[model samples]
Each structure stands twice: as C-alpha cells, then as structure tokens.
Target: MQLTTFFFVCITNASSTQFWPGFKILLVTVVVLLAVKNYKFLVLVSHALFLMIP
Candidate 1:
C-alpha cells in the first residue's frame, strides 16, 4: 500500500525532466547503500529495474 502510494506520488510529482537527475542520484545512493549491506539484493533490484525499463 505504502509502496504503491509512493510510486504514484513520484510518478505524478516528477513529470518534469528536472526531477530525474535528483531521482537518479537518490536511487544510486540507495543502491550503493544496499550494495554495502547485501550485494546480491542490489543486483536483484538492478535487474528488476532494467527489466521494468525495457
């Protein structure tokens, strides 16, 4: 529920290209932090994101 809401919020709020660089930086930071804790989890997330994109 919370995840869906967050996704919707991001989609709605980030209609401008200006928001993307910050979003990418934030996502990379998160992935880096997760990688430090569990590299496999980061890989899984990266794969999922890649598949979601194209």
Candidate 2:
C-alpha cells in the first residue's frame, strides 16, 4: 500500500526521461531494506506475486 503510493508519487514527480532510472534505484533500496528486515517475508511475498503473474 505504502510502496504503491511511493511509486506513484515518484512517477508523478519525475520527468519521463528520469523515471526508469529513479524507479530502479527506489526498487533496489526497497529490496535491500526488506531483505535486511525480513528475508522470509520478502520471499513469501515475492512468491505470491510471482504466482499472480500470467
């Protein structure tokens, strides 16, 4: 929920040319934080998300 809002804000604030690079950095930071805080939860969440993909 918060991540989605963060991503949306990041997108709306960034210029199109800068969006991808900025988003990549944001994603890496988030992944690292989640990894450090709870690797198990990250794994489960990622697994569930992956299953949702077509």
Show the colliding residue pairs in model 1.
none
lDDT of 2 by residue, 1-54 (tens): 576445334434443334567665675466557646765646544654444344
| Model 1: per-residue Cα lDDT at residue 18 | 50
Candidate 2: residue 52 Cα off by (Å):
18
Q: Give the per-residue lDDT digits (tens) of candidate 1, residues 1-54.
A: 454344434434444335757786675566567556765655565554554352
For all candidates in order, the CA lDDT equals: 0.53, 0.52
Clashes of each: 0, 0
What lDDT score is found at residue 34 in candidate 2?
Answer: 64
Best by TM-score: 1
Model 2 error, position 21 (Å): 1.0
- Candidate 2 off by > 4 Å: 1-19, 41-54
Superposed Cα deviation of residue 35, candidate 1 (Å): 1.6
